[model samples]
Target: MARYVVIGGGIVGLATAHRILLDRPDAEVTVLEKEPRLAAHQTGRNSGVIHAGVYYRPGSLKARLCAAGSRSMVEFCAENDIPVRVCGKLIVATEEDELPRLRALHERAVANGLPVRLVSPAEASEHEPALRCVEALHVASTGIVDFTQVSRALAGRAEQAGARIRLWARVTGIVTRGGEQVVRTTAGEVVADVLVNCAGLHADRVARLAGVTPSASIVPFRGEYYELRPERRDLVRGLIYPVPDPRFPFLGVHLTRMIDGGVHAGPNAVLALAREGYSWGRVDPRAVVELVGHPGLWRLARRHLRYGLTEVRRSLSRRRFARSLARLVPELTERDLLPAPAGVRAQAVTADGALVDDFLVVAGPRQVHVLNAPSPAATSSLEIARHVVSRLPTDRSPG
Candidate 1:
């Protein structure tokens, strides 16, 4: 039997291990997590919107996986009794200048085989009564669910399949000995015939530890949110998104109705001071120094200085953020927005200063490292896991 060691206990790692055990029942699968519990980082902190493959370029891994994964996710949720809502989404073009890009996005969605429709202002208002738009693309496959719950289910199913999960076990080093990979962690050392790194935030570092040079560096972008007051939740029927500015990497802030009936808004993207930094005050000197020293970050900043400044302004001023949201939902006010938890995105920046726009995976002998998986990652976890597992060399003898 093969021995598989997976680093990171996020949903992707759990799903990968689960798939491996299902495919090779006698294989020994072990998962190592740095946190005290699974989904403690990106998996738990995200906005929980199931992407409908609307924004990604056609034929990209993100586009393909998100489209297939969204369907699989709903099926999985239904089968496992996980709460899910296919509430749909409206990507509005508030200004005439944004209409061209919105049309382009609609074309991309069509090319990707999503059932999206371009709606007029009236149709858009019918879907979201409070929304104000010149034009919009209605994506029916978009929805919301509690990803933390999904992660828990995956963990439970993986454990049931005989996979061992070690929590609070931070991987310290990896050594190759006698044709087997030995992973040294805080809890103990684990030896495996194959190692898969699904380390989201520290994926690049983990790749380096495994003696592979990744093509990009992980730059954490903090997305801060505001929740609508309970009385104002009715303003958003499902999800309301702004047509993203093509110049920026992040999807602009929008309103989303959660599975639990709460509406969240305004996740303004800003450069985070730490990998797990949820707030501006939570800074890590090392992370700051590393980010500052990165030539790619500097180049990225130079190219998008004005937009970056705008994001920083929105991050600091509640009124600014509310104004941006108000462009989509005219009735919303600054007072209606309350502070919500923030999520840090593990964005990968290439050496030449371009943000990696698709899912990136790198492989070495007996090892696979998921280098970049940001937004839609949670939605695409299972499919991404299948892709990762398929990439592993199958010709190796069982250790």
Candidate 2:
């Protein structure tokens, strides 16, 4: 009988458990992970970029969490001997028409209290000789690291602090008996006074299992990447992003230098037909049908029809994808890159086809569940965990 049961071993869940122990060393917490190891989903399968709190709406959860979390994340990494580098990032205006959007981003960053600077083309070139941008903003706080290592360290620290973690415990249902929750898993069951649903890909489903009302559904979007051809790997010194279209939900495909040395390119967002579908070949009829039948998806289809169609075209044709890259780095050609592993996003959407723009959390009498935590989640894991712990009901039994 643990005091708290955290479903999902991703960074958020682990961080929540870690914080609970940090706050109350005597507190008993159990972390249930479906996979045999942690960080197997979005946590492990990301571009590894440490966001700099830019691009988030001012006064929003993203802005506050990312700014604080970025600093806490780095400090946590340093304290735990985890490897992370503030390699910085460049948000470039490759198209003349994109300058306005870039300027707007710079303004937004300022409003968000981010320490960003406008870089001249030459100055930008000094940082990235291969980068071709009319102008760019240098975000010094952005960095890169292996989130898997971070997650592992957090898990270790949590367990060290007297928390328990169960691997291969795929939570399938949550039964509420009296005032406690019995988390049903493949292994068996774990009862808890509070249940934190931090399940990433399966968050919505898990919440429903916990007898919570799901306001939105998780729509999987696969972000496909490409590695710079070995010879041209030097083209990107760090993260290089295109000016995002405010009308779009995602930052346009850009190049990001991985902690492992290679630069990954173009995580073009595409609707994944399956929950964990990573390839075009992978499909789940139910998932596909559910998505297609959704009014929000149809509305999204209408709103970004052109961009969606172009993404679909690029997704199927490497040549078109390479051309999209050429807008920023003119020297890049189709031959300069190779396919890389893809990551899927568990995007929560409303019935009206609008993307959830902020962090969404729902509360219970005895539990608090993180419903939707998007991009900055990895960057904001520690802070998110602290917040979750702060909200927990303290009077309970130790498992």
Candidate 3:
């Protein structure tokens, strides 16, 4: 029997398994992935920007890990000979009214121990000539890298460390038999001394299936993006972002320069009709009913009705979306933006209407469930993995 069974072969699970093997090379680890390959969902589809420790409250898990992981991930990439660039990110405040919020953001970054600088409008323009802003906070530590490449490398490391990755293996049930866990997967039954669930989109469902209930439900929010028309890709030199609205839990749409040297922009967070729905046509009635049934969803909508309405408006109206970008870069016209791929976030919300702000982990006698891992999880994979593995019961021998 394996020592550990890691469910969901995304970055977190693979990183956890790899880290376990790193500590105890003799431990047998098996990673069960529902998809054909790793990171095919959120991890693979993300914007590929290594987030700076900006936007999160100081001293939170998100703050601690994002900053530490930002450095660690960069080192891992360089050490592994993966292609990466330390092209910093710019959070531009386009309006006179937005400057105060930008300053608050800068103060948070400072509190979070990130090396950030306040750049004047003229100075901000020096780096991004076409961008217009009252001011911008330049995070020298923020950078861009391909998370998929990093994930593949981590998977390779895990394999080299003696961890077995089983693909297209959806875990249907997890039940403890006597002192061990019976992980019923598509491949076959595997009994192990320990289990870890790192399912991103279906994390809550996975936990429920595993007989652990958390307070929150996962709601899928679709983030839509548009690439700058090829003719005007020069509008963004690196990453450009607007000050996000505080009313909503989401960090509003922003422009990013991908590691592949392409500029992509806008990930407007809107309610998706289906859990995995990428386009407008793919709607699941059950998912819709379940999404609507969550009291948190209703409470969140009621509390942020105006903000919710605005996001829906932007989703339906390209002119409105373009206007949002125009606020930061006046040079970009509606015709200059073209449709791009969308990424749906697995946003967890409390029944009381609070968006789970930081990482949530629950530990059992024989298992651990990663309930909610917010943004930068991909960036903080190794550190988060270290944390997760350390929580496992060390006294138990392999089953």
Candidate 4:
């Protein structure tokens, strides 16, 4: 039996562990999570939208994995009795200037083999009654699901397969001795033949600890959201997104109809003070200092100073956020939206100031580190697990 230790108990880690147990029935698999419970960070905090291979560059890992994962996720949700809605999504162009981008996205989606179509204003209105769009790309495979529920299901399946999950076992150090790894944790020490790092926000740190040099640094970007008041929920029938600006990494402020029967809006991306900073008051001095000292961040900020300043202004003003949403649904107003929880994304930024666009995986002897996995990661978790497992050595001896 091969001993496998996976750090981080988010959906990706749990999914990887589940895949290991499925492949090697006699494998000794253990998951260590710093948090008391699973999915404490990114997996639990994201806006539960299952992407449909749109926007990503065709043939990229994100495009391929997301396309395959979308189908697989729907099947998994059905098998596990998890609630999921394939309500579709509209990438709308409110003005003539955005129409070219909208068409380009539609072409990209089609090239990626997704079921996408360019919808006229009347056609878009039929799907979302209040939406005002000159043109829109209707992505039929786009859906929503509760990822926390999915994580729990994955954990349950892994546990049933004889995998052990230790909560609050924060990994403090890693030492490779001979052919095995000694993972020192807050609770105790664990020895394993192989280690997989799926730590989302702190992935780069984990890689460094494991003696691997990641090409990019993890920069936390906080996405703030607001929920539609109960009565105002009727305005959004499904997901309504703007034609994203090709220059920025973010998918501008949009509205989503969540799986739990609530509609959420905004989510303007801004730099967070801490890795897990969800609010302005939760700033960490060390994180702030590190960010300020990073030359890459300075370069990125210098390039996108105006856009970053706009995001900051929007984050501070409800009216600015409401106006962005109004571009999608003219009926929406500031009063109709209430403050909702926020999510922080661990975006990978290269030393040259460019955001790492694709999924980045760094490997060392007997270990693999998932350095960059944002947005569609939850949707792509299963495929990512399979891909990671396939990369492992095939000649390892059974214990």
For model 1, residues 1-399, the per-residue Cα lDDT tens digits are: 788999999989888998898778888899999999999989998889999999888899999999999999999899899999998999999999999999999999999999999999999888888889999999999989999999999999989999999999999999988779999999999999999999999998888888888999999999999999999999998999999887666899989899999999968889999999999899999899989889999999999999999999999999999999999988899999999999999999987899999999987789999999998999999899989988887746431
So what's the TM-score on candidate 3? Answer: 0.97
Against the reference, the lDDT scores of all candidates come to 0.91, 0.88, 0.86, 0.92
Judged by whole-model lDDT over C-alpha atoms, candidate 1 comes out at: 0.91
lDDT of 3 by residue, 1-399 (tens): 338988888788888988999987888998999989998878877888888889888988888888898999999999999988888988998879988899999999999988899999899998899899889999998888888888899899999988889998998988888878889988898888898889988888888888998888888888888888887888889988898766565777788888887888788888888877787787999889988788888888888888888988998888898898888788888898898888878888999888898888788888888888857898888889988988887747531
In Å, residue 85's CA in model 4 sits off its true spot by 1.1
lDDT of 4 by residue, 22-100 (tens): 9888889999999999999999988999999898999999999999999999999999999999989999999999888
Error of 1 at 157 (Å): 0.6
lDDT of 4 at 203: 91
Judge candidate 4 against the unseen true structure and give its global Cα lDDT, from 0 to 1.
0.92
Ranking of predictions according to lDDT: 4, 1, 2, 3
Better of 3 and 4 by TM-score: 4
Error of 1 at 207 (Å): 0.8
Query: What's the residue-level lDDT of 63 in candidate 3?
Result: 88
Model 4: residue 322 alpha-carbon error in angstroms:
0.3
Residue-pair clashes per candidate, as listed?
0, 2, 0, 1
Question: Which residue pairs of candidate 4 clash?
Answer: 1-399
